[model samples]
Target: MASHVVDDTALAGFRTGLAGDAITPGDAAYDEARTLFNAMIDRRPAVIAQCETARDVAEAIRFGRENGLEIAVRGGGHGVAGTALNDGGLVIDLRRMRAATVDPRARTVRVGGGATMSRLDRATEPYGLATTGGRVSTTGVGGFVLGGGAGWLDRKFGPACDNLLSVELVTADGDTVRASEDENPELFWALHGGGGNFGVATSFTLRLHPLPVVTAALLLWPPDMGLDVVRAYRDFLEAAPDEVGGGVIYMTAPPEEFVPEDMVGKLACGVLVTYAGEMQEMRDVAEPVLGLDPDAEMATECSYADLQCMFDDPPGYRNYWSAEYLGSFPDPAVERFCARAADLIVPSPSQHVLFPQGGAVARGPAEYPIPWRRAPWVVHPFGLWEDPADDDRGRRWAREARADVEPWSMGAVYLNFIGREGEDRLVAGFGPDNHRRLAEVKARYDPENVFHLNHNIAPARGRAG
Candidate 1:
């Protein structure tokens, strides 16, 4: 069926019914509104509904469906797949809905769907409370939690969805619903790793934990030492406490004050050790790596909120990212991982990272669909570069990295860290059993499969309209 063009009268009606702006092409803000994190995605949505409330979202979806326009949901626009925007369709942009209401006494925080990690982190920081958030401050809370969130605090508090208390959503039928343990329990379970297939999450209420201070220790060495450092780091993490978290990253050395002049802007390896407690305890925990004779090191105690944004990726770059969960990272696997770093595009903002998992993450609720949590390690190649000509090279680097570690892969992976691979990979993100269960939930709430943008799970044949 061919998509029908939205007429002026229908567009006018949608514009009139919204409490926010309905941006169209030729509008002054259209270009700025359509831009996402990856500059490679140049899509032109027929209309950009900058929704401010849940009702605005409902109106946008209804308008899109009635006009035969594909619907795209834009949260913080951090997804590498560019699923948040579509070509010549309707975009339900939620960037205007940022709000964080903290219930400090109850140890819960309700965040708007469009709210970013910074919004939620800053809101709870003053109360000395925090939750697991994405590595960067700009990631959307809805996408992160709904898609199995992971971050520096994950090893301590578990993935972000583990802290999920409730979700307020606007379904495909334009009905407002709430999913929680006590309400719509099945839908709530599906929301654990279901992505945006069921509905548009207008807000999410998450459980928070007490976190007064966080210590971050960054130790850097030349690229040649990566193999030894990775081996020692793996040994240290195997016996490390739950409060100890962070990753081993291989990237171009930054030209910061602490970095030696010779190593600046050159290929290098670094280990970031994040401790959930005070600074002194972190130093004690990170001593194993520090003793390796790092050429440069910076360790400091800072608020968790501030640390969240420490490595935020700069926008306006072409990006291609992929991941493989490993059952084990033995010496040979470490060698392959480090050797692949040579293929990385240096003099750019790419990172070949190895993250350890096995604390609250591995011990998190087994019922949730995030099967990758059991894996002891993850190899993530996040490729970001400025030149458009580097697009093929960047994508090949990420693909080759996944192939390099394929032998050790556990067959389960995190969907949030990757782009569109295929349907099989989607099922791999959630095991086949969970896929069937979530498909039934998709049948119940969004039978039409109207929201099929992010890691979509199609409704069962009989259930789909």
Candidate 2:
């Protein structure tokens, strides 16, 4: 696509109407505005509209359309595919709109689209309330929730979309609209997992749950014990209750007080158990895996908000990530998953993970576009490294991890857990039937496919724009 030349006079006029600043390529903050979570993505948008309100979002959309610029919506900017940016186009930067308000009595939170999991969690923590949020603190609530959110609390409260109450959106045609169960019912249904296809979500109203006590346990073993550890974890989760969450991860052990000195910066297999209850209750429920006699262990009760930030993946590193949902985690599959850990770049932040998917996730609203929720396990290879030369190795490791478990593949995937794979994977993200229905809704709100940077759902044919 040819980059449009934005006229100075027109840009000035666009800036006059917006409640936010219009930053161009030469602006002092332009570089910082375009940077994303993955260091590999380096795109330069023609204009970056740092929206402060819903009105600013609407005006930015209108200006981008008028200027014939490809528009990309920026939230927390954590997407591995880097859909939040476009080369020489327009970026609707929502980072400035990070405001979260809690209604303790109603058990809901009204969060600005730019708000991160940190903002939302901290806002509700005082009231002892929270919703299912991304594992890390920096993930944008908008993209995470819209793409079918999963986190430590997901097993207890269900995926983030299950708790979604409503959204305030700015469509491709510069119109502001609200979607909820009682408002725009079809649009509301599409928002469950449609991502940014229909519009830019300026704000979200999410149903929160009362969570007073939370416990986290991290047990580590040498890489050689991965097979036994994984098998034990898989069996333990098979009968685990909804209050139990977390996954098995093979990573380079960090230099922490709880980690053995020799294990630091070495490949280690760890089981992370997050319980939606007190420490004693967690210990009672997690006795199965805890009996393995780990080399290092850290078990404690912490606030939900603090737990969210404990595993924050550092930003400046290059990343490559992929996932495959499995029908079952058999012994052979376990062996394959454990064997692939050797290929991971050691002494780095890369992680080979097996997250349990049952309890609330398997029992969530079945009608949503999320098709991977029913799978029993998800094998995610989260690759993070500092050297640019290791990019190819990083990509290969992640791809091979998914390939190893393809035998038990459920043929479905979660969009948030992966980058742009292909059309088949895109369709798999939302099952075929849900894809068609989402396309129809896309036709109604975004017939032009202006918000096509995400895991795009094309507008249905024969529909008016």
Candidate 3:
């Protein structure tokens, strides 16, 4: 860890050049600025530079490098690993830079790096245009898109990176640059799934698709019925259209109007089916799962922006999440998946999820570094709880869930879904060949590895620094 005591004179000079405020240890908002989504992460940075523009980002980078301070970038502060903050370093906080510009006629939207999914979705909602966004509305668009975004609409619109038009970035040398197909083409390709290894993205322009409304159905049954329900769901999705998207989740049933009195605060199997079309069409297509006689049901047609916020997980919980992509989901796998649901902590927000992935996601450009996109099924164990004593239990359940389905493992996992597993898993996220190519790009843009907090890719050897 790079540690250098910042003097009062130098600190004052750095703050004067920024368009935003610089928070220190004694500042009133320092504690709130360092807080992240996962309560387990309690890092206190030496300085938090709340940037308001690309110039501010560049200035912060230069200041950190000159002062021998390790730099970390903060977008939505939702990363499970909490790499967005360091113990005694500089944090380039982009939370204040959130701004979105919609060009409906061109079918594109330019969003600031600090912008959340809610800002982007709502900006395009009135125009009846939207792109693939994070499942949670509060998720940061920059991190989500750069980490290969997946959502309910990905089956029809493809991953968020596929819709990327261009990015405005500030490199390690404090030099501003633009990357697209026609400009800095190699850097643009690396941005697809390479994460923040190369530079700090100030803004992104993404292509939008025409989407008027969507129908979402949340059907629930007792925990014992998961095996049969999952089998039926797998069969239904095998023949379903690309417009249909959803997943099977085993979670603690909430006390909603539709939930049965006995099911609340207990383990229950729920199936969500989101249709890109109308309610009547969704009814016709989802007949198989809809006929399963669920004990609780909620189906309605609403705006796409509204559906994004429907299942937003509350923050301030100790979170530990992992994923395993499977090439096939056989009968034995179904049994194992259901058996693990019993181990989940009851009356908590943890979810044992099975998501389908073979639509526009599979057909999208295969050259991107996202190797997990081809897997037909993904087993994600998302653990969220309120008690510190349950940390070991929460982590064990997520790890055991992945161990249960390792037989059908695709060997490639989404980098965003899991924390720092290992170098082998990091290489698996981007294939062996893509990793090599990304290293070369990293050597060109950030040879010193200034942005090493993410699932880092080292600079290629024997390259100019």
What's the TM-score of every candidate structure? Answer: 0.99, 0.99, 0.99
The 10 consecutive residues of candidate 3 with the worst lDDT sum are 2-11
lDDT of each: 0.93, 0.94, 0.94
For residues 323-439, what per-residue lDDT tens digits would candidate 1 score against the true structure?
999998888899999999998899999999999999999999999999999999999999999998998999999999998999999999899998899988999999999999999
- Model 3 misplaced regions, further than 4 Å: none
Q: After superposition, how far is residue 338 of candidate 1 from its true place, in Å?
A: 0.7
Please give the TM-score that candidate 1 achieves against the real structure. 0.99
lDDT for residue 169 in candidate 2, whole number 0-100:
92
Candidate 2 local lDDT, 190-308, one digit each (tens) = 99998999999999999999998799999999999999999999999999999999999999999999999999999999999999999999999999999999999998898899999
Model 2 clashing residue pairs (backbone): none
